[model samples]
Target: MSNKILIVDEDSKIRKVARVYLEKEGYDVLSAENGVRALKEVCESEISLILIDVKIFTMNWIEACLKIRKNNVIPIIFMFNEIENINAVQVLPSVMGDYIKKPFNSEELIEIVKLRIKRYKISPSYQKLDKINIEIGSLTINRDTRQVFIANNTVRLTQKEFDILELLASNKGIVFSIEKIYEKIWGDVFFESDNTVMVHIRKIREKIEEEPENPRYIRTVWGVGYRI
Candidate 1:
């Protein structure tokens, strides 16, 4: 069955456009004009993923995401028109599976949705691990619980960061190009922007590394991409 995606945005135009594109891609699309209605839909229906606008009436996207996370582990992508320092530093990490900056290509958005769904669809058994425990230096990843620990301190990672780390760590010594990483994690190679990957990588490094400038687990390959 096709995955069901719930879109929550204040703009009718964005909702209409996203619905059209996602429907064409064989997804079951549903939409709401604000967080209140979106939360209602989430409670009432079976949704595999969510695309949320950070600014909305009744409740903001962060609040909506917190509410959703309280009850569900469904993947959520947060959309913003501009990336303010406060939003990037505080708001985005709290409530999103991924953040898509606005003026985005429709095709890229569709691909990201597909990638998130694909990740969700993968069963635990498909993961490459001797058991559920994954150790890299002082960092330990518990696959079953989706928890990460770094030298006795529990490192908090958003879902997307964890996925990126897992993908790199799983295939150690392999140089994953930006295009390859986008396709593997976000599900679309069409919108392989360096900034998008950079933001995610920076965030991940901040959480897991002692010094993000000189990282241990995830490392940059210069002209290539990232490796663990």
Candidate 2:
């Protein structure tokens, strides 16, 4: 069966919007107006992933996520307004698969959903590329294990972060404009001021560079893009 996605929110409009776009991407979309209905759907359906609002009308999002996670391994993506403590949500009982800030554009939402679901279905062993490793400065990348190291320390990175690092490191010294990088990695047209790629780049630098403000490996080209 095609992967099924559940969108749980009290607002019918949000559910409809999410469902329409998700369905367009060839996913089987299901939605619940409240946590009770959401949990019921989880019990009855083979849900592949869940997109939940932080504030549901009937229950707290973290509570609902914790309840569902007690039994299911389905990936959960939190949808929250900018006002919420987004970073704090990461420490909830169950792992939050991902989060999207409020007022997200359709393309951005879909991209995040696609990447998260892709990671969910693919095993780590299979996600790794064949026998390729790169070493630059203090950074070491092992494509076989999809891991990065700075000196003797292993630097933890999200899939997207690893992908970005791999791209820049593999083609060392090649300047990649933000738009080009987005298109190559995301397989989509880049949009203006989409900070998604930029955010990941910053995070990757913090993990790999000794000093992010004065990055040694990943260098910025001012008005252009980034290179290593």
Candidate 3:
């Protein structure tokens, strides 16, 4: 199937220009005037990536991204007119793939789009799962859907967070160190000083655990690692 990219922007000229450039590279382009329209489009269609404007008038870009992330993990790129000191940080890494400043170079835009989509495709979470739920008390993790729920209410987790949770939950009794967790989830070399896994674990606890200070589900193994 051809890769389809959704561009959400209020400016008709910007959409038209993006479509022209993207179509030349054989990417099917879809355009939405606002975040509401973008949300509707995402639900109705299968999109590989999204290019959204930072200055959305009808709806907030972060809100739009969170809504999309409810069911889809499609890569999202934010567009900015100019960098006003670390503008990219405004777009959350969990919901955002990357950002390109307005009046962006066609090569840069295309490269960013290509890289984000590629990364999403190769991500372990994007691959096939058993379509089963692993239950741990009130928490329910659906592997296939990549969703977490407490009782009946859904809990939002970043892709990495979910992956880490699922890894421990699936194994149940196994203990995975921070290095192992990082290497397994990230598929990369783990630096001795890196606290990436620890940080994500803390974030996951904040969202899922009632009292992050004294967590109930995920238990720290003191000097070793964490377990569910």
Candidate 4:
């Protein structure tokens, strides 16, 4: 998978901060101080995702985004300081994948970068699941469509929830530590304070388990992690 991220911003500080954190997380980080350089980088290299500031010094940021999206569906995330500025560039959600406010936390920036890159990596046409259908007790997991069904009824799950469940279901009977699960899904370093995975597990159990306290499909190995 291409783990390249192109960061476009006028401020050198922004680029430096992003490059430092992203490279530390194992991404091939590239940066541009202006739109011309940014476009040239995209044309010359395989960029997995883009993080662009809505405000740029050399060119209109919105026009830059439009030009980039003209031929590529690579994920693009907007960065801006003010909420009003974000609203100004409210183009089709299809063109813009996500946004992050400036002065963002290092952890939050890393998390978003990992998520966007991970989603881009798992293209339906390119990536294949180990198993298409996973059955555990009354639960049914459809890997192709990323859906879960229980007793012939659909169990809706958030993207993260589905990811955690799919990971466990496909590799049934193998206990995965919290660090492993977080790294596999988030594509970034895992910290103990990051309860994002834990929360998603709880939510998945609530939707799929008859008793979340004592999950049937997803069994928690005490002080270890979880398994199916």
Candidate 5:
């Protein structure tokens, strides 16, 4: 299943906290403050599921949901507050629920997101890639098999190495910071002293990259991070 989720909420604090939690579970999360930007994200990105606030003050999100339903069929989980009346969502067939109430716990949010993403995949209308593969130059990654091949020769990688590579390869242009990479792969908080991601990147380059010192597939952005 795709590990990309979008959180649509006007509250910056909510978005940040939810982002941190979801990233720990290896999800690449995108956020939008209101319906306009949220609709733009849904159109541009392959968002596996959407966690939208029931009350979007910036714009009418119910209208957004209706618009989304016209084209896409991804899971739409509502984040509602106790005081807000979510009766409008009743007409939305795509709404998984309005169960995520305000003052919600992170665990509940994560659980609901996971369940919806998994459950929605069961639909016959949802298209599944026959072969989940990523190819960059000579490097070919079969995500389903968790295998990497360099010009027909299988390249052996440690589990972490493969995870890092797949993370970068799957999101080609996006540069992930060392901290972000460490958290997503290790599923733990990264300390400043930790060079774990750097070490793993080196090992992956040695195996798949023709020249480890001057890598082709995984390029390091000076002082930023790595990207494919």
Candidate 6:
């Protein structure tokens, strides 16, 4: 299946250019000029990735990214006019998947898209399971139906959250720096703040950990990074 992508930017010229290039690469593209339309498209369509402008029609990309993280795991790449305003290490803990300074090379953008899709394929969380049952302590992850159960109660997780959990679980004892984790999960070796990863981890912990303040599965590595 051709991967579908959603592009959100207020500038029609930018959208047209992006659409042209992406279409030439054989991707089915959808676009929105505002956050409202973007949200609608995301909720109503089967989009694999999203390329969003950081500033779009009264919508803050960070907040939009966070909202998107609440429901979908689709890789989100933020395009900004200035790289200096973004904190690559600190923001990695939030909803940032990748960061592209404006005036991005068309070829580079395509490569990034391909890389993100490739990484998503190998993600432990997105792995298909033959069985419906799997256990993680009191939490049960249902691969067949895409559901997580804790103490017989269901815990809903966004696609990104599940992906992060799967990565950490797949390498239980291995420590992953925020940068490493961002690269692995986001397919972007160059990213914004590390906090983007931290924020997502916190969200995941809130859902699965008995106490997010003192997590059991996902652990912080002080000045380094995180581990499970």
For all predictions, the C-alpha RMSD in Å is 19.8, 18.8, 15.8, 17.2, 15.0, 18.1
Q: Is candidate 5 or candidate 6 better by lDDT?
A: 5
**Model 1: per-residue Cα lDDT over 14-68, one tens digit each:** 8988888888888778899877788777765557799877666234645666776
Give the Cα error of residue 204 in candidate 1, in Å: 49
Q: Tens-digit lDDT track for model 2 on 173-208?
A: 899999999998899989897988899999988988
Kindly list the per-residue Cα lDDT of model 3 for residues 1-228, writing each as its tens digit. Answer: 457799998999999989999999998889999878887777555577989887763336566677768666788788878777235445455664577887876898889989998888887655532236677887878876677877534688999999999999999988889989999999999999898999999999998999999999899999899998
Superior by lDDT: candidate 2 or candidate 4: 4
Instruction: Assess candidate 6 and give its lDDT.
Output: 0.75
Name the better of 2 and 6 by TM-score: 6
- Sort by lDDT, best first: what order? 3, 5, 4, 2, 1, 6
Between candidates 3 and 6, which one is better according to lDDT? 3
Can you tell me which runs of candidate 2 are displaced by over 4 Å? 57-64, 85-93, 124-228
Question: Who is ahead in TM-score, 4 or 6?
Answer: 6
By lDDT, the better pick of 4 and 6 is: 4
Q: Report backbone clashes per prediction.
A: 0, 0, 0, 0, 0, 27
User: Which candidate has the highest TM-score of all?
Assistant: 5
The total of clashing pairs for model 3 equals 0
- Tens-digit per-residue lDDT, 1-228, candidate 6: 357789999889888888988999988899999888998777655567899876752435456667777654678887778755455433446576787777777898899999997886676544542133455566566554566656555688998787787777667788988898888888887465447888899899988888999988889999888887
Candidates in order, TM-scores: namely: 0.49, 0.49, 0.52, 0.51, 0.54, 0.52
Q: Name the top lDDT candidate.
A: 3
Worst 10 residues of 5 by lDDT: 123-132
lDDT of each: 0.75, 0.77, 0.80, 0.79, 0.79, 0.75
What root-mean-square deviation over C-alphas does model 3 reach?
A: 15.8
Model 4: clashing residue pairs?
none
